[model samples]
Target chain A: MSGGSGTRNTNTEPWGSFDDHLIQGSGAAVIDMENMDDTSGSSFEDMGEMHQRMKEEEEVTAEAAATDDDTHDDGEFLGMKGLKGQLGRQVADEVWQAGKRQASRAFNLYANIDILRPYFDVEPVQVRSRLIESLIPVRMINFPQKIAGELYGPLMLVFTLVAILLHGMKTSDTVIREGTLMGTAIGTCFGYWLGVSSFIYFLAYLVNAQITMLQMLSLLGYGLFGHCVVLLITYNIHFHFLFYVLWLLIGGLSTLRMVAALLSRTVGQTPRLLLCGTLSLLHMLFLLYLHFNYHKIVEGLLDSLDGPHMAPMQRVARDVAELTLNASVRSLGVTLRAQ
Target chain B: PDWFHWTRTSFTEASRPFAGLSDVSISEDIPVEGDISVPVGSSRRDEEFSTLDEPVKETILRDLRAVGNKFIHVLYPKRSSALLRDWDLWGPLLLCVTLALLLQGGAADNDDQGGPQFAEVFVIVWFGSIIITLNSKLLGGTISFFQSLCVLGYCIMPLTVAMIVCRLVLLGSSGTVSFAVRLIVVTASFGWSTFASTAFLADSQPPNRKALVVYPVFLFYFVIGWMVLTFSPSQ
Candidate 1:
């Protein structure tokens, strides 16, 4: 409670960023001490008193910064300054070093104290409640902002490509091939998007705002790396659905981690418990839908792919087909020749 | 009469334990040093009781009274109840099932069709679920499985409406106009899905600062994933 009010004022200042409060509070505390001593006595008498008081205050401040207790370093101070003129420069250097060390220690102490002070004044229970309330806005704002910046950007690109591919397929006269390619592209895009998005959202839900955008991106990279691993596994196993499910599981696990962190930070257990229950219900439905509809969708796609269409070489279709086929064949031939 | 009966009954219940005690014999429990014996439940017995000594007795009685008060308070009826009174587990389950069914059904209907009708529907529902679920999970509220499914349903409703609008717009439009519209539609799907993917990852497992380097990597992979899925023979 020594500088409690001053600290509170600093903390409550409008738009008081972290550095602002630290610098302001420390400076104010020192200045308040200096002013109190200056106003206490007569000019000449006070001059001598002021000098001593200033020295005492400086020492106290330095000590407080170094350690809350002020007893240990008195001898070192006396030794450094006792024969002042004899080694004035040396003494000055020592003082300078002491100042640097003291300043750093003070900074460290201040940061620790500020973070811990909230716990002392507010019960852990109360702080937790506030933290949960605070989380709502933090989640809302952070979720959309991060997703818009990170997730949406890549999604846009993928959709564009898919659209182009679809357009190419639609124009193709080779009914079965066009249908098959189109179906595959559509299905794959659908599956990939579903898997990736689910995974990404899950990842987003797990992290805290203390995390920087860069860190989030990197974690996302890890998720994609996870995706790559899944893809490799899927390729080896030759099970598409498994791969999709695995991608989702990874996403879900990642999201669960974020959810856990958020829950840990949250004050009440009730809301989180409810939320989890709700998610479970939704998950079961999604699973059920996937189970029931997967075959029918696949069948529909196959039928569409096999439906009657123009001949194999409509002008636009011919151009794209030739280009893609040639490029792929060329790559294959090069690979074979290399082998 | 009601008040008297209730009070008498309560008092009787409270006093029953004390009434059951019979003999208090010091000599039977321990050999008496001299001839000092105390009678049980006598007026003089209060002074003989060690616990009845002024300071000690006061402390013991105070503690017992406090415990009895606490017990009585606990037995009192509660004042308020929870908001979710009629909530049932099956309701949420059914909603979730419905959403999943819609998604699967739409996908089936639209598959391999040159038209974007059902694909649009499936993507909308699927992506909507992803976004809503991610948000709900991150927010840490009592989001029931059914609530999430409902949210998924609600989120996709707009997309479904948009698809209908798109069809209407394309009816009288030129071929190039149609192409552009389709392009826009597909782009939106990809973009939204990609965003969902990244968001899902970001929200799920938060990486350290160094993980920002992975943004491009994720993007690259996302594109690759999209390509593979789109072009794979199985699809």
Candidate 2:
């Protein structure tokens, strides 16, 4: 009981007014940047200047709203010059804001997984919501913030790598020395992420999707988070095909969700559809490869990534034995069986 | 016009409470405190807001000198965030002892393999923690190295429970029933440890670095969870 009382109580919570401060900070920064831009500006002016302008505009807008009674439109930005550029700037600004939250959600979202499905459905603000943490990564026209998502992707890679490393370590104590086992597992985890991310990036680029390479890396990283779950559990458990399949199904769904979230709406609808469809099939194949070729691939990677353990003479001698002595032994056994 | 419609949907939901007000009236709702219309955004200076200014307690406890107190802290992580600082190793040490004891029971090798199995598991867990610590450091995380280990080591509590269940299943069940027990226990613990540890490590990373650190910590636990699931007493 005393131990309960002993926990170091903090005077201030770790995060104080963090959410509000972040919003305020971002607004200030956005306004500053917008005002500074000669063109491609997202908002109107300097803080002091903007406040005065807003006050004047508020009266004009109030009168307009009352007279026109058009709830959605009390147009002012529209009547100003260069409408296309203005719209582009606005979209760029909103996307910047939405992406920050999206990126965080991509990482922290599943830490509360009892109701992943319902969580996405409940926050129906954008198409981004529909795809995040969901199984279907349908190509939407937006992406989340990059830096956290970028770092988060690497974390997933590390998770997958750690899973493979520990699995190898688990076997080393159980079975043979497997000197190269850890190295191979490490290489495989790294290679899988790099290869898959590159492949997806290529697909996205082919379709002219607004998906960035960094976002793709994050998606791959997060996608592998689910796979790491699958590998950690299944690889350790013995030969339970059903359990493996079920975990794969769930992991695939999440990966698909990331794929959808990564695809920018700038992508043509046709190629975006093709890319998602292709990636889905590719993911299934990848799972099958993991399942069926698990041992074979590990062994091959061990040989490749493990570097040279045996001396060249030792390898040559073994090859000679297989060619001459083993062949002779096989023939003798066949002849004896015939007799 | 097309772009306006898109932005409207994306942002309008948050602005809905003001929809009924005229534009001038809505602007008038800007909160005032002292001389300024403060840029608090969603924050309000309401008296009912819970204050976090409590008496600060040092996470390190003098009671940690006693092994019993250490064990108690191990069982109850929040009782003392000793792991949050450098004052205790008991939490990880006790968790390991309990884990080894649990794993030792119903083990296939039983007595001879007991010490080795426990050592292997302990080493793997600690080593995995180091991987995460290093990754966080690489990403410019602010959490102290030992603090990372403490969060990771304490997270073993859930997996230890799973190990206890494994020992129980070994004692009382066989065949299909045994497999079912193992699966359920490991999965639940896997979920708990992954989520719990993430909560601790989540804020430590520069928000940019979370993907790198959090994901690996998650995978490391997954590996531990797998060991618990696959464990069977030797024939």
Please name the candidate that would achieve the greatest lDDT relative to the true structure. 2
| Highest TM-score scorer | 2
DockQ of structure 1: 0.01
Per-candidate RMSD, Å: 29.1, 17.2
**Candidate 2 Cα outliers beyond 4 Å, as residue runs:** A1-149, A157-186, A198-212, A222-285, A301-339, B1-68, B77-79, B89-123, B131-143, B155-222, B233-235
Chain A: TM-score in each model: 0.25, 0.44
A207-310 per-residue lDDT for model 2 (tens digits): 77666676666566656655555655554443355445755677767756765565443356678677777666766666555544555555455456547783
Docking class of 2: incorrect
Fill in the DockQ of model 2: 0.07
lDDT of 1 by residue, A201-239 (tens): 453355322333433332232223333334334333323
